[model samples]
Target: MGALDVSKIVQGRQGWRLITCIWLHAGVVHLLINVLCLLFIGIRLEQEFGFVRIGLVYLISGFGGSLMSALFIRSSISVGASGALFGLIGSMLSELITNWSLYANKVAALLTLVFVIVVNLALGILPRVDNFAHIGGLISGFLLGFVVFIRPQFAWINQKRVAPGQETAPVKRKHKTYQYILWLAAVVLLIVGFTVAIVLLFRGYNANDHCSWCHYLSCVPTKKWKCNSSPQTCTVMQQPNTLDLTCDGTGTHHSYSIAGATQDQISQLCNSLCS
Candidate 1:
């Protein structure tokens, strides 16, 4: 039931929408895409690390995505699991980095992952897509990977394989020192990032005001398609049998017969004219 509505979040203080929105989608196609992506990327993660950690990454990354979209695009509604899906992708990237020593052909794997991430992010720049959410989710999941996906070193694995009571030296720490450092740094960064973003969102801070070019990340104009991100505003004059609409932004005027027309119908007509 929850969709990311900026007014509801800021005015009504419905912060839970940030988490709940991830469960909703704009349409069937949106839902199907996310499901297939989750199947492709998430099942393997669950098998490798189990569901609990991956689920945490999904939910928290979704919240981070919602917070970011709210800050940048405050005029529209957003609903989808793409952000959570992007989180899984980000987690895969970080998982590879954290477990670098475990895999052969590391360079090829790294290059392939980078290519996939870049292509997906490039798609987000199209109109009506929420790239802010994608970026935010990617960052959150990337940091979470360091914290939750830390693997035991090969030395630790070898030590564990030794027979009981035949140990020559003491058992080494399970994780490397660098892993602990990365884990701590990631934890601090996630905490700080979430806190700051949440505070700014509740305060109704529009990120566009600070970064003039940030909107281009979500949409770019092209010859084939027009990218209009601004909201439409219109004034209406209604009579018993007719209605007149005037777009405030563009000063375009149109009229339509409203005989026996419902208010919802008139509103929809006005929106279409304005858009």
Candidate 2:
């Protein structure tokens, strides 16, 4: 009843937990946030597409979120509908774009939607947030939105272009060659990205250290960092003002020894550990 643990999903092979975890909430506060977000985003989608389509999007996006969390976070037990909430946000973005011609103030609506999505995702930088789920749900929802929300006229199946003055059909739209190209490109990129992400996840890549571009997102430079790769032992330095650290490993255990004096070369000694 708690949540789905990544280890169980991976090593224990409890796949049913993926969907079950989405229905569970971490706490009352978490439940409130998801409910509010669902009301805001889910209701509108349901109004337009009806209950069935929106429901499918929510569940599918949530499942996608859980799948990514299981793959990336090996030690976490994740619960909540926030991933699905982000999915709704993503769906709205694609919906707006797919039906852009129908809207009068496209730019304003788009800006507002983008601002909200950015703010929510930025807030995910906080500790304990399941950002991987949000990201997975978002990408899945965005891609699905294009296919799920296409209007009948502008849809690829029926293509007809009408001039400014003359219109035999109620809606005048053409299936442009570029739209098909872009959609194909998006699918290719999505598959490639997911594959790369899985490879890096198994490679034990720390986004904090390995991906410098993402350093600005969730990591902050701290002077209090300590060397955790090896245990340290200090030795009085023969030299008066210099410090040196050496590392050695035997079997599985690793050790680091520092050769230096305190106060005389304290800054250098401490800096060596952090560096």
Scored against the true structure, residue 91 in model 2 reaches a CA lDDT of 81
Q: Pick the candidate with the highest TM-score.
A: 1
Go through the candidates in order and give each one's C-alpha lDDT. 0.83, 0.64
| Per-candidate clash tally | 0, 0
List model 1 lDDT by residue over 164-250, tens digit each.
777656556888788889889999999999999999989978776566457678767676654554666667787788877765533
The TM-score of candidate 2 is: 0.66
lDDT of 2: 0.64
By summed lDDT, the worst window of 10 consecutive residues in model 1 runs over 246-255
Query: Predicted candidate 1: what Cα RMSD to the true structure?
Result: 9.3
Give the poorly placed runs of model 2, Cα more than 4 Å off.
Answer: 153-179, 182-275
TM per prediction: 0.82, 0.66
Query: Which residue pairs of candidate 1 clash?
Result: none
